[model samples]
Target: MESDNKQPCQTALYEEEETLARLTKTANFQGASGINQQSLNFRKDQMCDSPAERILKQLHNKQLLIVNPKRRNGIILYKRYHAEFAGPGSAVGVSLDTDCQKILPVGNLDLISPESADDRQRAYLIRRQWVRLTLQITENPEPIGRAQKIIEQFEGFFDSATIAKLPDEAFSLLVGVLPHTVAKVRGKR
Candidate 1:
């Protein structure tokens, strides 16, 4: 009886993986531009929507697509994937860089696999530091002033010993406020 159940379980797992692969592939193909009506229709067909409109409605709710209101036909001008922390066959992770590339802790959070507690602690600290930096940037209005303030606040968060021990990337991220704040600064240079 156990052996009989195993086959069905394996089949279900295989199907689920295949579906995920398809979804990921479709999502990546979209790029930053937009998907056409044909692609949207294909997705709707695959999902078995009785009408194309309903599928589009579902996609809008999921935030996978955005419709242009000015357009006559309610044209979808952009498609965005739901932010996923985990890739295929992987677990949830956190984005650490400005570009949003290079996810850390690439595996199931519950399992922890080979990552140590120290590594997890460092990631947590980085996340906290990012939140702090973001809040400081938002609260301040002047660009140069905000940048200087953020730098000072970041420095104040660490002691001389800890500052010397901090990673280059962490420092870069902490001090990377200038570029982000410049947009809000008055007058073009």
Candidate 2:
């Protein structure tokens, strides 16, 4: 169970959507001095005018967008996925959720064993796959439940099939059903 803190620029971009809206409307971002302090602000020295400014920088660095903001196409999440590998001896495999990349106060639920050779081998394949899973709520331990559900679901479609055993189509299928179920995300609220 983890959440992504990988792309700060991405984080900034989404978080600053409202600010960007204001900036686009007014074509101005004077930072802390501006009336929209609730959504936008400038730190001391002000290396950049806004989060949008930094997002542009990151986009350019990644070559996802051009240097010109006037003609720039914003970065879009074309695809989102959780990294996973077949956990040996279990019908379910280990996965790293797009959200779970940090070690928060999430409860104890260790699915991967360090002692097992297969576990170590799987982990060694992708060290950055999972950092931790934090549940946030002490009373509600739903995160663990969520993880278990993911494993259970994965096992439904795939069982003990190593990456090699799976077909080319399997990857695409996994993309649809992730370590965290997608139905809850795209389903009716």
Question: Which candidate's lDDT is highest?
Answer: 1
Q: For residue 13, what is the lDDT in candidate 2?
A: 43
Q: What overall lDDT, based on C-alpha atoms, would model 1 receive against the true structure?
A: 0.34
lDDT of 1 by residue, 67-147 (tens): 111111111111131111211122112232222322221111111221455555544454454455456564655546755
Worst 10 residues of 1 by lDDT: 68-77
Candidate 2 deviates by what RMSD?
17.7
Q: Which ten residues in a row have the lowest lDDT in candidate 2?
A: 101-110
Clashes by residue pair, model 2:
1-133, 2-99, 2-100, 2-101, 3-99, 3-100, 3-101, 4-99, 106-134, 106-135
Alpha carbon deviation, residue 85, candidate 1 (Å): 17
- TM, every model: 0.25, 0.18
Give the number of the best model, judged by TM-score.
1
Candidate 2 structure quality by residue, lDDT tens digits, 12-75: 2443455556664553545435455544334221334444344334333332211111211112
